[model samples]
Target: MHTCAPPVETLEELLEAHPSINGNFGHLLLLQKDADDGTLSQALRPYFESAHLDARQAFHADIGIDLHPDAGDGDGPAVTYPGCLPLTTRKGLFGEVLAGLVTEGYPLVGEHEWCVPIFLFRYHEDARNYLFSLARRPERRRQTVGRLGSDFIGLLLDENGAVIRFIAGEAKWRKTLNQSAVDTVMLGDLIDDPAGGGARVRSGKGVWNDLNNDPPVPIGVRQLQRLLQEYDPDGYDAAILSLERALVVREPVPLPRTDLVIVAGNASATRDTLTCFLPFEGTPPEYTAGHDLQLVEVVLKKGEALIDAIYDSLWSENADA
Candidate 1:
C-alpha cells in the first residue's frame, strides 16, 4: 500500500479548530487539541500510528530490518521501528505526516481524494548512511535528520485517473509558536552581527522565499512520478504520463499547483491566544508564491507528552504479543 489510512474520526474527536480565514492568495487555519474531550489516551495513539506508518515501513526496509508475525524465537532480523528514533527525528516526522493528513482529510483549495502515495523517508541519506555504517568504517555518530526537498506531496487525480493538480508542502514543528520562532521559519534565521554594533539580521532565505522560487513543476513531482512508475507502473500509468508531460523541458503542460505550509507546535506562553503566526485578515506578505496556498497552524498542549505517548504505542500491540 502507498499510504496507510488516516484516522479521520480520531482527528475530528481529538482536535478543535477556529473558522478558516479565506483570502485571495490563500486560506489560513488554526487547530488545537480540544480540552473538553477527555479520551486523548485512546484517541491519540491511532492518530500518531497513522502519521508514522510510511516512516516505520520505509526506514526499516532502508536499514535492512525485517518483520514477521509474532517471531520472537530469535530467528529473524531485529524489527526496528521509527518510534524508537531520536526526539528530533521523531518530532519532524510527525510534522510531515500530520501535514499530509490534514491536506488529504480537509477540502483544501477545492480538491478531494488527495493521495500521498509515497513518503521520501527512504531518501533521507543522513539517517541511512549513519545507521547502515558497518565495522570497516564505524559510524561516527547518529544523525537525527530530516528528508530534503518538499516535506509533503499530494496528488489530486481527475475522473480519467490522471493527476490534475499537486500540493507541495513545507511542514515544521516548533517548541513554541512565538513571533521569533515563526519568523525564523517563514523568514530567514537571524544572521550573525557583521559589525561591532550588534543587530539581528535575517539571512534572506526562508520557507516563503524558497517556495516563491520553486519551479512551477517541482522536483518532488518528478520524484513522485518516478516512484509510481517504478513501483506500480500499470496502476499509476496515467499519473506518470501526466507528470511527464508537465515536466518536459519545452512547452510542458501547465499544471495547477498548491503550496501547503504547516506550522505545528504549542502555543507560546508569552503570546495571547487570540491570534496566530500567520495574518488572518489578508494573505501573508511573506508568502509571495503565486500558487494557491493553504496555511495550517496546529497548536497543542503538553505536545511532547502527547507525541511520546502516541509514538510509543505504535505497534505496541504487535510487539507485546
Candidate 2:
C-alpha cells in the first residue's frame, strides 16, 4: 500500500518542507502527481512562456549573450509560441524552477537575497541551433557544445544587496532514483580533486573559482560583477572584498559558496531513499570546505514521462482550439 504524503499546493512549499536526512544538510523529496487532464499545464502556460523569454532577456542584459537577436523584434523569439518547441520548453521549465527557488529564498551559504537564472544562458544550445537554422547555417545544426561549468549558477546576495555567495547548482531529470544514479548526477560535474583522494571539491580553479578575481574572469561571473557595478557600487565593493579574501584564506574559513543538487525521478514515497541514496553519512567531509551543500529530490509518480505528457497535452489543446 502506497502511503499518501501531505499534499503541497506549490513547488516552493514542497521544497521548503522536504525532510532532510543529514542534520547538517538540506534534502527534499517531492512526489508530484500526474497532471490533471492538462489543467496544470494550461494554468502554467503563461508563466512558462514568460519565464523562457525573461530568462533569455536576463542573459542578454547581464552577459550580452543573445541566442535570438530578433527575439523581441515583434516576430516572437524566432520560435513558436503557446506551443514552444520541446527543448525550448524544457529550458524554460528549468529557468522557471530556478526563479521560483530564488523568489522563495531557498537557503544557501549566505543570507540569501536574490538570484538570476544563469544556467540556461550557459547550456542552451537549442536556441542557438534555431537561430543558426534561421541564418541558413545548416552545417552548425545539431552540433553539441560542452558545458562550461555547473548546470545552474546563481549570484546570491545579502539583505544589503551585496553579493555574498555564489550558488552552483546541478539539476538532473531522470527515471531512476538509485544510489549510483543519484551520486553520479550530484557529483559528476564537480571538479575532481587531483590528489586521487576521491574527494569531490566544489570551489576550485577556473570557472568554479571565486568571481572577484583578477583579469581573464569567466564570462558569466564577469557579467555578474558588471551588473553589480552598474546597479550598486557598494555591493560591487563587497563582492570584490569577498573574492579577495577567498584568495587570501589558507585554511577553510566560512565563505560565501554553495553546491545545490536537484534530482527529479520516480520513487516510492514510503521507501527510505535518502539514507540509501545520498552520500551524507555521519559528518561528511565534503562539507568541510565551509560551503553549504543542499540536495533536493523531486519524485514524480509518472517520472520522466510526466513532463512529456504535459507538453503533449498542451500542444493538443492548442491544436484543438
Candidate 3:
C-alpha cells in the first residue's frame, strides 16, 4: 500500500514532512526578501549547528549556490540575491531556485516535491566529471526508437556511422529510485534478443538467426520519415523541426511511438505543442553545471532557438495549408 503525502508550500516544510525522501536527509532552504521591488534570492542553506540565526546567515552568505535557468525565457525584470530580493518585477525567481536545487544535487521528486539536498557535499571537479560524462548524442533519423514505453536515453555515436552507446540516469539524491521508476524509463526498448541470434515476436513464433535467408535489416531515417508521413502526417513538419532541434542541441532524438520528449537532466514530458514540449525525460527542473553542464546548456539554447525559428518559417509556408 502506498502512503499519501501532504502538500507543503516551502522547501523547508517539505523536508520536514518527508525525512525519508532522498535518503532521509534534511535541508536548509534560504531566501532573501528585498524590500524594494519584492523580488527574492533563494538557494539551499548549509546546515548550521549554532542556534543563532545570524551565525547561520553569515555562514550561508559566505558559501552558497546561485540559481541559473537553462535558457533565457525572453525579456523580464532582474531578480536579486541574498533574500532573492526583488531587483526586477519579473516572477522568475522560483524557476531559478528550482534550477539551483537541481544543480546542487537535488532532483524534483514529483509534480510538486523535490529531493532533499543535505550532506550531499561535492568537491566540484568530481561533480563536473559526472556531468560531462552524461553528454548526450545528437539526434538522428538513422537511429531506432525503442517501443511504446521504453526508458528514454539519448544516443551517442562514435566516429563510425554506427551507434556506440547512450546515456540514462536517475537522480535520487532525495528519494531512492525503486523498480517502478526504473521500469518507467526502460520498459519500451525491449529487443527480443540481447544477443544477435534470433528474432522473437511479441506473441508469435520465435525464429532462428538466418542471415543468409533473411539479410540483416538496417533501420534508418528513411523509415522514420515514412513513419511520420503515414501516422503523423499533420505533424511531419514539426517532427522534422524537432529532430533538427535535437541535433542542434546535441540531444537524443526521442521515440515517436509515444508523446514524450527528454529534456535537460534526463527529464521527460508529454506535452503536444512545440514550445511547451519538454526535450528530455523526468521532472522539468533546471540542471546545473556538472562537467559538461556548460556545453549541454549551449546546445539546449541553440536547439530552442532553432525550434522557434523553424516554427516561424513553417507558419509562413503554411499560411494557406
TM, every model: 0.85, 0.57, 0.18
- Winning candidate number (TM-score): 1
Estimate the TM-score for candidate 1. Answer: 0.85
Clashing pairs in 1: none
- Estimate, for each residue in 199-241, the C-alpha lDDT of model 2 and write its tens digit: 8754333221322232222344544454445545663586645
Model 1: per-residue Cα lDDT at residue 110:
55
| lDDT: the better of candidates 1 and 3 | 1
Write the residue-wise lDDT of candidate 3 on 60-127 in tens digits. 23333222233245332122111211212011221222233332223222112221111111112222
User: For candidate 2, what is the TM-score?
Assistant: 0.57
Tens-digit lDDT track of model 1 for 1-321: 344666666667666656463643445455565542336644655555655555566666666665555644745433355654667877887787677778766666554578888765655666655555531244344546688888878898988879998989999889888878888888888987666477878876888898989989888788778768877999889999999999999999999888888888888777676567765555677777777787777888877766676666677775431
lDDT of each: 0.71, 0.45, 0.23
Worst lDDT run of 10 residues, candidate 3, spans 290-299
Where model 1 places Cα greater than 4 Å from the true spot, the runs are 21-24, 34-58, 70-79, 134-141, 192-199, 319-321
Q: Candidate 2, after superposition: displacement of residue 33 in Å? A: 3.7
Q: Of 1 and 2, which scores higher on lDDT?
A: 1
